[model samples]
Target: MEGSLCDLPAGLRGDYAAAGPDFTLPQDWAAYTPADHATWRTLYARQAALLPPHAATAYREGLARLDFTAGVPDFAEATARLRAATGWSLVAVPGLLPDDAFFAHLAARRFPVTRWIRRPEELDYIVEPDIFHDAFGHVPLLTQPDFARFLEAYGQLGDAAARIGALKPLARLYWHMVEFGLIREGGAIRAYGAGILSSSAETLHATTGAAARRLRFDLRRVLRSDYFIDHLQPTYFVIDDFSKLFGAMRDLPAQLAAARDAAPIPPGAAAPGDQPIP
Candidate 1:
């Protein structure tokens, strides 16, 4: 979910307060109309067709276990299948929650997915994440074992970073890596980030787009980088393996504190330590 940044009001007109202090909500699946399902199917069919050659193996493999032949998937159904496969479950949220709330959900192996769907007009772009982006873009990778733990670790790290006022740098890590990252496969670039996975235009651009700067994943460098969220990413960090995310993050807590005041490397520019991909 690319723009899973905006915080939707919790008790608004459409919000459904669920039975938890964590502020979850029922998906209210019955409220969705035929158009919503059609919209989701349309988005899925288009992205699914192109993703095989561009998306990472874990994403593609995780995608295979779920069936999308039907239109939109009910949250309950997706949650059940996901839980059985990797002990991960999706809960409905009004939209993005606070940082702590988001981290708490992920730390518990529960992903808080926005329950609403984008309208037909919002198919190409939307400022906030909807169900299509959350479930379609992010959920598949949760099925992969290594990537799954990395996400859990991310949540824990995010929790620690927040306390020490190092969350801004941490958010940049999430932006460039989780939301808009690229990966290398069989000597080619591929996308694993949900933002790119969900956007057909960005997916194409990430692999072959002009002016796109693809850099090797350097944990210290990435944690200190900045990114643009309102448009296509000008830069993407590429990891050699999904497991590398877990392996390289062992020293994250200490690194975050030490680099808390480090000047951020602007998007599209090579940092002093960055090994540019050519």
Candidate 2:
């Protein structure tokens, strides 16, 4: 989900041609090889083992309610559970999609997940988001009411951001908060962002490594910040609660404009007034 559509590999490009107008496709559950399911299980077990001490409570609770450990989950089955929990459903897609199409799906409460799993060689790293990243990393949080609402609200704002040429800043909001954010819980920092939660290295690095800077979340600073997609994030914004995340949407348009007018803050640099979360 983090990569651009242009970044899709040439071989995988066929999935785009086979996709429907909305870029939606069937999960083709039966096509997954036994090896594919094994990869999912390995990734699941490894990440799950590391999550208890580092993951956000909401994410852990949501993950507990789903059955993703045996193998790659069937989208239809996962959809049923998600819809029952928070009015959200899963739809299969090729990989990264056009911005408009991606947002439209989210606005309708349908999450578009990649249908293919990563190869054995790509177990530790994949250039683009694979099924593991889209489903295992992102889906669990969709079960939380506030985080779910926040995502829908984000999708609703996509058109406006596009209209005003403010999509860059808007994307920064998604990158920093939705993909690589951190949170303070019970006096310790925890990971809530999909990007951090999904990777074994990042899960540890983001929570305990001294290399990255963790600052208290500030809507304006986040909108003006730049991030790295090819490597672990150098900086992360920490939110006090999901409610505050959803509340920031109230003034997003104005903030987007202001962010567009300001120079971007470098990935690991802190602004003068940035509140460091220690």
Candidate 1: tens digits of C-alpha lDDT, residues 1-278: 11222454444423544424576878778888999889988999999999878999888988877775467778788888888888999888877677878888888999998878888998999888888888889998888887888888888776679779998878877887888878888898999899999999999989888788888998888888888877888888999888888787797887897668888888777777667676
Give the per-residue Cα lDDT of candidate 2 at 39: 92
lDDT of 2 at 53: 92
Steric collisions counted per model: 0, 0
- Model 2, residue 39: distance off in Å is 0.5
Q: List runs of model 1 lying over 4 Å from the truth.
A: 1-20
Q: Which is the leading candidate under TM-score?
A: 2
Give the TM-score comparing model 2 with the true structure, all chains together. 0.95
Best by lDDT: 2
The whole-model C-alpha lDDT of candidate 2 against the native structure comes to: 0.88
Q: Residues 1-278, candidate 2: write the lDDT tens digits.
A: 33354644465633787788788887899999999999999999999999889999999988888878899998888889999999999999988877888888889999889888888999889878889998988999999898899999999988888888898999999999888988899889999898998899999999999997899999999999998888888898999889899899898988888888899998888788889878
Of candidate 2, the 10-residue stretch with the lowest lDDT total is 1-10
Report lDDT (Cα) of residue 216, candidate 1: 91
